[model samples]
Target: MNEKLMFRRWLDLASQNILTRYFEGEGEGSFAELPVRVRMISRFRWFMLAVFSFYGLAAYGAYQHSGVGFFLSSRQSLVLFGCMLLVVLYNTFYNFFPDKYIHNRRLMKVQAFFDLLFVTVLVHFTGGDVSWAWPLYLMVTFEAAILFDKRRSVIGFGFFASVLFGFLLLSEYIGVLHFIEVPFFEDHSHHTPLFSFLFWIWVCMLNGVLSIAATFLMNSLRHENREVRTSRESLSKFLESANDLIFSFTPEGDILYANSSWHNSLKYDLKESHQVKILQIIEDSARAKCMSNFKRVLEGDPFRVMEGRLVARDGSLIDIEGHLTLSTGPDNSVVLWAICRDITERKNAERQLFHLAHHDQLTGLPNRMFFVERLKQAQALAKRQEHKYAVIFIDLDRFKIINDTLGHAVGDSLLKETASRISAVVREIDTVGRLGGDEFIVLVSHLHDEEDARLVARKLLKAFTEPMKIDGNEIFMTLSL
Candidate 1:
């Protein structure tokens, strides 16, 4: 019993080795009910049955008529036909109930070995060196090459087929096995023994060489195909994971492809993005300028960074900086490719800095620096156009006394009210700015005469006479011009 168990273990290991030798990575999926090895075995079994059926009918018919197609005697031909039929029936049953037996690599290897062994037996009985079934060995070699993508497997199966055929010839020649009759072709049997043996050896070697050559060519093609597939997958992943908005568009402003960031920035979902036109998201005011830039880029001009506004889903505007390029589309026509980065925060910060430089943060009015700049521009205009402009410098009376009597909050409120009152009295072309403390300047430009400045001064004085309200307190204020 122990010897039997040991023999079984060794047999199972050998069977597994044979199966894996031909089908290394064909099908060993981790998340499936059936293994790929079993499926391949079933397919190989069906393929063998088809080949056998075609040859069996032809050989049996030839044997029954006059032994013209096959070299086997009538009894031997019948036996071969019966054996082939039995194998076909067995495979058909196994295919119907694959779960009945162990459908694993080990079992598949045993089935494949038996399949070759039977073919070898038929070859020996039919003709040995000159058998019509010799092409079956090439079929087996090609099957192994396709199933196993490795060079070693293809070369191994090639050499194994050659060795098996040589063994059949040697066994019969040395009397270990016996041939009942010569081949169906009578004239070939009269050849010298040495010449016949050499011819058979040559035929076996030639089959091995051809099998190896075919395997090498097929393996090269498969390798190239895999490399191309991997490169395409890598490029797709890069596009999906990019941070900037990357997209392709037609010359007619139709969007073709948009990546993850592109859809997300525009507040569009995957399904909605495909239907959106490229021009729809652009701000109405910037669309014409943006399209002009797009046309220039499409005309093969060098690309440059562009600034524009994009209207978001919530009806808010987002400032974006973009880079554009041109490429061939699916129809070989010119298409535009663009990468847009959200620069909304950066643009907001820049606007804030400009406002702070020229305006007072407390009263939201133009500051002293802006007043000086406006005065210089007025001086230049008066020098050039011979037009008169007046700069009115006003000071609030007793503002310090009011601030000391009340808290600073009331003073700030009073200053804010004073700024508003002064701004209200100015003309559209006039500039009003705070010069720190209670001093303010009015730049009245393009005035017709000195009387216009007096009218503006009268308006400014009348604006404070109504007793201004400051933080729920009615405060009387006066200013001197």
Candidate 2:
């Protein structure tokens, strides 16, 4: 390829989105607007095309009338039209090119350069040293403040505008270039060469100052507005890394966000949680307590710690102990946050320990310690109501002989059968317990007389009359009370 072809290929491959970058904010921590920014820049391109087309038509009309009202000669009008077409050509070229991040910022700078160059031409043709179009320079400077580094905006746009405008005015004043005079505006060409130099210096210094001021002011406002975005980002990252279940919910019970630990422990899909209400995840038995706490949080009475049961996605209950707090969101909406540890295994272990301590493991019957407590309660109730109560201590006869011959397992089956038989004959309010090996006890209360106690004892003795079927062996046992 030749040098001209290589240069043309380079220009065709270039693409930029300065307007998009400015709207999205220029650098780090600037996401969440990428998709919206893309569409905005697409519309801005059409707007720029409309502006170029409008000016092109104006120049074309002037050319047809030989500088009639627009004060454009044949050559100047063609030059303007041709210059617009150059920008249009590049703009059209970029439309067909795909945009992606190669991390090159030069594309924006190059586009800005072209814009400044084109505007310089317009400033000179419309009015020179006394140009009414100087505000156009500040407009581009404002854009530079947002989309480019502050230091670079000062040099690239501010100093560069001064150089272009100064060169144009100085050239025209020195008679090196023809100064086109607009019809109504005073001819600045007749002004002294020193006046042009002094005007350039004034413009140059002012650009530097205004560019710096605009950059700082814009940066301050952008940082202030970014507080919400930064807070959300920090919360997501910090909460997600926690081992405890962490979550946030709206005041209306809608779950807003849940960390990975929360979703995993609950067996819930994070993506589907938007439709799941906060109280819906709590176990049915615990919903009332959770709702009470939820209301408390809304009322600014959040708890320091609480115990709750959460219903998992698979309909299993999970015991959790945690703390909940009320918080204000970026939109000033009230929200609740929680950090909970899974206490399911620990709670299960506690229940198991209680069962073992107060019940007979082999017979699955209340043991000596529990039976004694019930005896004390029954004594107190009988005294209060002036009723008689009786305690029967029954021992199985020949229990040791059965265990030695038929084995301990068979012996255990006999004891369990005995407990069940006794329980069936007694009133529901009565207590039956296995005190120890081959030893059982019963509590009979609300008796009318000595005759009532005798009747219950007779019923107990008859319960052992039937043979017990244990481990496919039949055995007869008698009880002594």
TM-score of each: 0.55, 0.72
Q: Rate the local accuracy (lDDT) of all candidates.
A: 0.76, 0.77
Most accurate candidate by TM-score:
2
Backbone collision tally, model 2: 0
lDDT of 1 at 75: 78
lDDT per residue (tens digit) for residues 172-276 in model 1: 777787664554457755335685578667867777787778777666766666676688789889999988788888888788888888777778887777677
Q: Local error of candidate 1 at 308, Å?
A: 2.6
**Residue 146 C-alpha lDDT in model 1:** 50
Over 118-232, each residue of candidate 2 has an lDDT whose tens digit, in order, gives 7787777766877676766766665555546446654568788888888898788878888787665554444787877888888777777878887787566656657867897
In model 1, where do residues sit more than 4 Å from their true spots?
1-221, 374-390, 427-430, 444-455
At residue 154, candidate 1 shows an lDDT of 67
